[model samples]
Structure formats: structure tokens, C-alpha cells
Target chain A: MNQQETGAGEIKISARDVQVHYGDNHALVDVSVDISDKMVTAFIGPSGCGKSTFLRCLNRMNDTIDGCRVEGDIRLDGEDIYAPEVDPVHLRARVGMVFQKPNPFPKSIYDNVAYGPRIHGLAKNRSELDEIVEKSLRRGAIWDEVKDRLDAPGTSLSGGQQQRLCIARAIATSPEVLLMDEPCSALDPIATAQIEELIDELRRQFCVIMVTHSMQQAARVSQRTAFFHLGQLVEYGETGQIFTNPSDPRTESYITGRIG
Target chain B: MLWLTFLIIVAAAALAYVLNLRAARRLWAEGARLHSITTFHALYALFLAALPAFVFVVLWLALSGPVIGALVLSGLPDEVRAGATAAQENLLLSEIRSLARGQAFGEPEPWKAAAAARLTALEATEGWARLALVSLIAAAGLIYARTRVSASFRARQRVERIINGLMVFCSLVAIFTTIGIVASLFVESMRFFARVPFFEFLFGTNWEPQIPIREDQVAGAGAFGWLPVLLGTMVITVVALVVALPIGLFSAIYLNEFASPRLRAVAKPVLEILAGVPTVVYGFFAVLVVAPALRQAGQALGVDVSPNTALAAGGTMGIMLIPFISSFTDDALSAVPRSLRDGSLALGATRGETVAKVLFPAAIPGIVGGVLLAVSRAIGETMIVVMAAGLIARMTINPLDSVTTVTVQIVTLLIGDTAFDNPKTLAAFALGMMLFLVTLGVNIVALRVVRKYRELYD
Candidate 1:
């Protein structure tokens, strides 16, 4: 893949020739990307195109899956995340994730928001933890709908609210990068719109990396877009340029709905 | 003769099946659309022929013995029958029966010989009557069923109804069997309560059911307090739980969370094999191995231990119960969705913290239900306590002291030749009633806990 020229911005996460394998299946091959800080970078591809696999490698979420092996250097802010001293548990706190399905912990809404903060020791006491929870919920844009029932179970929320709750839970730890793997896939259109707006807002604080199947969603919320096809990064550039200008035939075919 | 009749009935039913199938096929060949397949009509006719004949044979077999005995008694001479008690009448009937079969001990009495001849004649007549009645009923049913097999006859619905009725009947048999057991226990317990006051049996500490075997026997009035026995059962159950619960739960957690697929495939069944070992074998192990080892260890530690202490029995019982708790707990833990585990881990919780704070709480209700089930099993366990725990019924909390459970007491009370009417043997029934109630209460609680908690995940 050719490195597209871009306006200068600080790189938050730099992946150099990353490859992932699941047993005999070659899932992602020699994928390289430089994700900028405080911007939304969306990875778009068809189903089974390794977009999600490459997203999981950002936070080491792939470590949970059996028979999955990740190789090559993935550095976060110039630090090797795969170093022996880097614990996946601690790495996940710094690189939070939102799943495709809105998987809220089977706990109270307040407890779900407080979980990451408590684990990362971000708050000193109960009041401080409550403050963090409120801030995260508000930033997730679900505070008004759920603030009254903070004590209610996280699973009791509607699909949109649960997805928002999961987002709040991820950001509560104050991570530098938020990895969202189709966070709006399981929500309705209105919920998806709310999440898209929240993603635009979250980009001001954290380097938001999302894997979405919707090309329109990538165009709407992302500053930089990476199109992955068949275990390779086919195109990476400014969102407007990738959608309009000619760079690769596969990218143009995918954008114009000719090939996916 | 009964077996021959049964065989004839079976043959008649088979012939009905063939005839009905052919009739249905003939109707279909004659350009009439049948509602059901040939097999349904065949089976319907077969059932119609077989069931009525079987019922007739069963009824005749049941009534023939009493009717023949009553006839023989009524025909006997007035001198032989005068003022005979029920027991005497039964004895005379048995002698007559044996003499008719030519198995009399010596030369039969004159009256007995006459009665035997009469009984033989009655039995032969009964056999011929039974055969004729069953065959007549089978033939009638076969004719009626064959005539009903028409082109549009709903034979399939009729057959399905019969099958549904059979299913309901089978279920009713299970329910009636349970009711029968409870009723028998209740009646026998009431009889025992008549001899020993209910309050005394429930509240009294002593439980000595001294049985008087002879008229001149002295000191046979036994105390029947149940407190010590109940306490002993509780103590042993508590000890078993203490030994089994933590170990079983932790092992279940490890097996569910930490074990690889290769290791789990081999380990789970090996652990379950412990449950498959019969309790009687566990009893033998407790008696021959565990008790002596515990006794020796206690002596070496400068503490006196009874040979049949609750510790030994309870420890072995606990070992026997480990698989029960572990398997149930493993099911409960594994039932927690993988998504929940992923959510916890993604939030950066360590594996131990994830299990301790999230998985454990989520599975608590199921785990409690499993533990309560294990408790019921421990309380009802018999062979292990009987073979290893002593016969002494002492109310003590000390595990090293020999104690007896309700089951062991029941076994001791009912063993050997004993009169059922006596309070000593009857006490077993009372103990059984208590054991049943306690276990039933535990099981109901466990079921409720499981049902109430199962909603959390769904």
C-alpha cells in the first residue's frame, strides 16, 4: 500500500507490518497504518475482510481468542505494546474497546461505569468515582436518559442505552485510544446517529479507531479512512480524498458500490 | 395356562393387525381415499384386540385365587370350619393348595384331601373359563375394530389419542407411586406415634428402642428421644459440607476457567467418576481405610479418637460428595455467558478479579442451589455413615466423637428378625418420615433458588 501524503498531525498508534494468524488461517497480512491523535480513524471493509481483526490487535483484545497469534510491532505513543513487560490487562486499560454487540456487564449502571475507574485506580474514593462515572456517562451522551436509574442494572437499558453505557464504561479509565468495533451495528438508526455524534465528540479527546462496515459512516465521522480488503490494507488517506479521488481501483470500486 | 392364554392373545392381535391393514389397502385400491395410512389402522386394531383380552386375563388371574379359596372353605364340613380365625383359615387354604399340587408334607387329613380335590376341580374350571372369556372379548374387539376401518375413518386420531392416554397413564403411575410411598410412611409413622407420644418422639433426647422378645423379659421399656439422632445427623452433614463445598467449588472454578480444552476433556469425566462410585463402596472405604487411618493419626497426635468417629465417616462422605458439588457448580459457572466474561476482561479486570467479583456473583444463586442439593444428599446418605459412624446416638459437636445418624439408627432398628408391630421396628418408619421431610424441604428450597436466579442471565 502507498503511504498517502497528509497534513501533519501527531501519530497516536503506529502499526508496522502487523500480521495476524488464527491457526492455519492467515487473517491479516502485513498491515501498516499510522493513526493520528485526537482524530477518528475508521477501518472499512466487507465482511471477513480482517478489518475487525486488525482493530482487535490495537488493544490486544485478540489475546482472549484461542489459537490466534499476532506478530509485528504495534507501538502506542512510541512504546512497543507487545513488549514482555506490557501486560494485556494494563494495556487494555490504556486502549479501551467497544464491542459490536452492546455487552454491558450484568451489573448496575453505576457499577458498570465505575468498574474501569476502580480497576485502574483512577479515583481516590466513592465520591471521586461517582464524579468519574457521571462525567463519562455525560460524555457518552446517555446521562439524561439513565442518570435517574444509575442504580438499575446495566442490562436493563434499551439497546442504544446499553451501547452508550458500554462506551461510558470504556472511557471511564481515561484511555489514550478508544477501539470501537462496529459499536453502532446492533443499534437502530437513531441510536446509530447518536453514537456517530458521540464519536465525533470523542475524537477531540481520544484517538478514536473504529471498524465499520458502512462506507457512509466512515465518511460521516472519520477524519482518516483505511480500506482493508482480503487481509491487506488497500487504501489509507484523508476521508474526502479516499472517497472522491482515484488512488486504487479496489477503493474506487468499493466506494462506488461496484465491489465490496 | 396363563402364559398360554397370553400367547394366544398376542397371536390374535397380530392377526387383527394383518387383517385390518389388508382391509385398508383394499379400500384404497377400490378408489377410496383413506384418511390415515395402513399402519395406523393396523395398530389401532391391534391395540383394540390386545388390550381388552389382556385386561380380562389380568382380572381373572386376580380374582380366581380368592374365589377358589372361598368356595373350598364354604364346602368344608361344619366341624372343620367351626369358629376358625382368619389366620387359621389362611393356613387351611395354604395346606389345601399344597395338597392339590401333591406337595403335602405327609398323608393329608381327610377334610384337607376333600378340600384339595375341590380346589383342583375349581382351578381347572377357572382356567377354562378364563381362556374362553378372554378369547370371546378378543374376537369381539377385533370384529368391531375391523368394521370401523373405512376409507374416511380417523384411525390416526384414534391411535394418537390412545398413545396420549398411555403417556398420561405412565405419568400418573409415577405420581401414584410417590403418593403410595408417602402414604405408607405416614400410616406407619402414625402407628409408631400411637405407642410413643408425638412430642416425646420429636423433642426427647434419648432414642433407645429396647425390644422385648419374650413375655418374661425385663428392662425392655426403651427411651425413644430423637434429638441426639437429629443432632448427630446435622453435625455430620455440617462436617461434610465444610469439607466438600470449598474444595468442590474451587475445583469447579479452576476447571471451568483455567483448564485447557485438552485437560478439561480428560479431567471432567475423571472427576465425575467419583460420583459414579457406589455409596456402598464408599462405605467400605470409610470403614476399612479412612476410619483406621484417622484413628491412628489422632493417636499419634496425642488425642484420643473413637474408631467410628463422625470425622472419618463425614470425611469419606465428603470425598464421595465432592463430584456432586463440583459437577453442579461447573454447570452453573459455565452457564454464565461468554459475552459477560469478555465484557469483564475487556474492562481490564484480571482473570481472578473477573471470576471473584463478576462470575461468582452472577452464578451465586445456581451455586447455592447446587450446595443445597449436596446438603440434601449428605443428609440422606446411609451406607457411609452406617458402616463408619458408630451406633451411639450422642448429641455432640466434636467431630472426633463417635455419633450415629438417623439412617444408621433406622438400619439398626430394622435389622434381623423383628416384629413389625413393635415400637423398635416401627421407629424406622418414623425416622424415614423425618428424613424424607428434611430432604424434601432442602430440595424445594434448592429448586426455588435455581429458578429465581436463572432469570438474571436471561
Candidate 2:
């Protein structure tokens, strides 16, 4: 299969000259990319390389941070998301996020998956709510392990299970786009593999964007990968090409482990 | 003279420190890799030399006066000793002391003058003996410490162990003091129970405690049923909590979750300043401001209001406790992980919904613990009630009505000239015992809830 053409859909999000500042620090400088609807696009970089900061900008999650300022044209389906008329709260429902740490609301496993759906009023009745929870859990690929113990507290699950539960919660709102920030970094290799497979399967339905520290994980899971360094998007293209024939010397050095 | 003695002992200790410090350095220079640092060796030497001498001097100072007085009193003329009570003996000794210090008026009696001379001689001898003994002990300790400062001596370990023991002793002081207070309260309550039937005291509804001090005066058989007093406490506590809990909790939620950082920084300290305002000041506000305002409002509304009402006291107390509850709740809500908050927001939940569904559940244990602890405080509040509430113990739960709480009744029963063994005074201890037990129970439950639920959230 040609990796660049694999399951690629219409452009769901577009960014041009996107810059972010935290207080006086210019954190992400002029990042521009197009995120397709039905593909896994990965952001890979060293620590503090601003990949996570750019990922946070997609749903206006940076608004929650004090002293954080974002300036650029960022749009969802050609609609400017940073327009004054847009409410970040509603924007978040369309662009859901999963964090590095598994943070389930200290509630039952059933409630954890149902949290987003219930909050957004996606389900009109109890059975609809139950159905949504079941679908989300199944989509998260942990339904078989947790279906019998839905009433158990979400925090009682192991680290990997909790991450999956968080994923289920994010997806329950039926978001058009999903942003994951190092979701599998805290998990074991086996768990990371399971999540990688789940991410691969998820790309057929929604736009899946992720920031990953591991270049190997990016090579394995992402259809397209963007390399970032020192607040700049150094190179972006098909994952195979970026790994095999990066245009920029900096990108090549980063891939070759000579400099971060 | 005592100050002079203390100064001498301190100087000796300082000298020992300097001497050891120099000696250790010389040994180190001579190529001995001492097990501990030079400073530790110096500190160890200083402590060993000074501590024993300091203790000896303090003990000697405390004992010398009593010992000399006993010697003089023993040599008192037989006529002065015969049939003299303890107070009289004390008077005679004081007279002798005053004469010896040349502060006595008029010519002293022959026996007193003779006693004064004897006291002076004993005191002089004792002072010299203490100085000599302290110096000898300090020198002996200093020399012994100097000899022990070898390569093998772990001065640091020894110093650390001593410091650890001192810390344990300090902590034990707090524990022992608490035990002592509880022991005294228990013993006094036991004495009261011996005189009054325990069940009657527990179950009685009436609470008049006016036992006349004079034998000729007439008074009631002193109804000590504590129910009315306990009821008064419950009513005020309810009123205070009613006024405090919702306002406090909401303010905490607003300050923690909704307020801008600049606004919270300014407002939180201002709220905490309300807590620092003395309860006595709150008492005055209840008596001088709230009471009158309540009465006027009642008149405007065509409702009855007492001049000294539970509402005035309880409401003012609630104002005083607002910061208490808010700060506690603030701590609890903030303690919820930021990642959980971000996760909720990322799920498209509004901030309000996020707090209502996720943060509240996570922080519920801490909030409940804080409320219970605050409730216990309200139950034990005294100054506001004493200043604004009625002295008569009425069982009414109405906030507008005059009432007396357990604390107020305790204050009234024990004030002025009253014998300890009498039921009126003894009743105070019994009431106190109940207050202590109730608050202790609330505190324990609050702590347990906080601990048990913290594990799940954290």
C-alpha cells in the first residue's frame, strides 16, 4: 500500500503562520500544517520541541493556561476556530483530547466513558447513553476487559487500562477530530502496542492527531509525520519519506540521533 | 546573683567549644581523618560540658531557697514552732528572709533576728558550694570530651542521636499536656457524677444551676438536666452552619474555580483576614450591630425579635467562620489534580459542569471533613454567645429567640464565688466533659474521612 494514500480523507484542519507565546517566551514559531480527516498524523520531536504546544493549539486548549498567547489562522473545515464568536467549550466537543497521564474522573468506569456524552447531551435517553458508553469502550478496545465491571471505579484500573478509559471518555463525545498528547508514553510496551493498533484502526473514522516522543512509534502508527525542533516545524511529509529522505540537515541529524 | 551564675556557665561552654574546635583542627592537620567533621566534635564537646553543669545549676537554684528556709525554720524557738499552722510557718520564714535582706520594718523579734542570721550564713555557704560544684563538673565534662575526640569517635552520629531524642521529648510534651488536660477533666467529671446521678444529668430536660452559697439563703434543688443546654448548642450550631456553610463553600468554589488570578490573589487574603479578626471582636459586632439591626428588621416585618437573640450571635459567628470554611474548601478543591480538570475541559464540559460533576466528587471527602471540623468549632464557640445570647437556658430552636449554649452556661455556672465541690461548680466540669467528648468525636470522624477518601483521589 502507498502509505501517503492510505485512508487519507478531506482536510479537516488547516493552520498557517501559527505562533504561540508563553509570557515573554516565543514557544511555537510559525507552525503551519494541514490535518486530514481520516488519517493518523503524528508530531515527533525532542522534549520542549513545541510539538505538544502546537497540538494544544488545535482546540484552543492553550486558552486555559495563563500567559499563553496564540496568533495565527487556525481553522476547522475552513472555519476560523480562533474567531471571537467561537466558544472554546463548544470547539472542544468537536476536537477532543487525551492527555499523557490517565486522568479519569474519580467515578465508575461506566460514568467515565459516559462523561463526555452526558455533558454534551449527545444521548437523549438512558439506553442511548448506555449505547454510547458501550460503543466508546469498544472503540477504545478495552470493552471485553471492562464490560463485566463497568461499575468499578475508573482509578482502580491499571495505568494502561486507565489511559484506554481516558481515550474512551474523549471519544464518547463523538468528536470529528481527536488530539492525543503522548497518550502511551506512560504505558508498558505491550500496552503501547495495543494503543498503537487502536490508533491505526481509529484513523478510518476521524482525524487522529498525536504528539509522540518515540520516533519508532511514529514510524509504526502514523501515515504522515511532522518533525519539530526548537519551536519550528523542520520537515513534514509522508512518514516513510521523512524517515528515509528528510530534506533538511537538522531533520536528518535529529533522525540520525546526532542532535535533538 | 542567679543571672551572674548563668552567665558564667554560658561563658564556660563557649570557651569549651572554642578549645575543642582548635584542638580538632590541630588533630586534622596532624593527618587524622576524623570520623566526623570538626564542627560536630566542637558542638559535641560544648553540649556535653555545658548541659550537665547548666542542669546542676538550675536544680541547685530551685532547691537552695527551700533547703535554707527549712534549716532556719527548724532552728526556730520552740514557742514559735508549737501550735503554728503551715501558713504561720510560711509567715515566719518570710519575715526572716525580709530581715536578712534588710527590707523588714521596725525591730525584729529576737527569734526572727536569730533566724535571719542563720539564713544568711546558710545562703552564703550554699552559693559558694553551687559555684564550686558547677565549675568542677563543667571542667570534668570538658576534659572527658577532649580525651574522647579521636579518629574513631562518631561525633556527628552522637550529636544527631541527641538531637533526635530532644525532638521526641518536645513532641511528647504536647502529647503529655493533652493527656493531662483530659485526665483532669475526667477526674473532675467523675467527682460530679458521684454527687449527681449520671442518667439524670444525661437525660434531664431542665438546666437551672443556681445553688445559693450562703446557708441561710433559699434556692431550688438545682435542676442539672443538661438537655436544654445541649439543645441550645445545637440550635446555635445549626444557625451558624446554615449561615456559614453555603456562603463559605460557594465563595471557595468561586475563588478556586472561577475567579481570575489577579482577583483571587487580592480577594483570598482579604477573606482570610476575616478569620484573623478576634472572636471577641465578632462578639462585639453581634452585641452592638447585628442585634439592633435584627430587631429593626423584625419590627419592619411585623415579627417579634429579642434584644439578645441567637440569630445575632450565630450569624456573627458565621461571618467569623466564613474564611475558615472557605480556606479549607479552597485547599481541598485545589488539591484535585490539574490533569483531571484539563481532561474534563477537553471533553467539552463547561467549567461549571466540570466542577459540578468531576471536581466536586473528587473534593467531596475534603469538603465534608472541613465542614464537620467547622461544625465542631461552632458547637464550642463561646464569646459570641456570651456577649449576645441570653443567660437563661431556653430550649427553643428559633434563631430569633433568646437562648444560652453549653459554653455560656458553663461560663455562668463557674463565675464568681462558688465552691468546687458544690453541684453548681461541679456541673461546669461535667458540661465541659461533654463538650470535649463531642468535639473530639467530630474531629476524629473528620480526620478519618479525609484520610480514607484521599487515597482514592490522590
Native contacts matched by each model: 0.53, 0.81
Q: Where is model 2 chain B poorest over a 10-residue stretch in terms of lDDT?
A: B1-10
Which lDDT tens digits does candidate 2 get at residues B1-458? 56766776788788888888888898899999989989998988888888899889978888888888888988988888999998999988888888999997988888888888899899889878888888888888888888888877899998898688779989999999999999999999999999899999999988888977679869877888999889888888888988999999999999999999999999999999998898889999999999999999999999999999889988988898798899889998999899999999998888999899999989988898889989999999898898988988877888899989999999988888789888889999999999999999999999899888877765
lDDT for each residue of candidate 2 in A1-260, tens digit (9 for 90 to 100): 45644557688899999999999999999999988878899999889999999999999999999999999999999999999999999999999999998898899999999988888888999999999999999999999999999999999999899999998888899998999999998999999999999998788778999999999999999989999999999999899999999999988999999887
Give per-model TM-scores.
0.91, 0.95
Off by over 4 Å in 2: A1-7, B58-66, B83-109, B116-124
In model 2, pairs of residues that clash are none
Off by over 4 Å in 1: A1-9, A213-220, A238-260, B2-61, B100-102, B117-156
List, residue by residue over B1-458, the lDDT tens digit for candidate 1. 88879988998899999999999999989999899999999999999999889988888788888988899999999998999999999998998898999997978789889889999998899888888888899999899999999988999999999899889989999999999999999999999999999999999988777668557767557888999999999989998999999889999999999899899999999999999999999999998998899989998999999989899899988998899899888987888888778888887899898898788888888788889989999999999998899897887989999999999999998887678888888999999999999999999998888787666645
- Looking at candidate 1 chain A, the ten consecutive residues that score lowest on lDDT are A1-10
Candidate 1: interface RMSD equals: 1.5
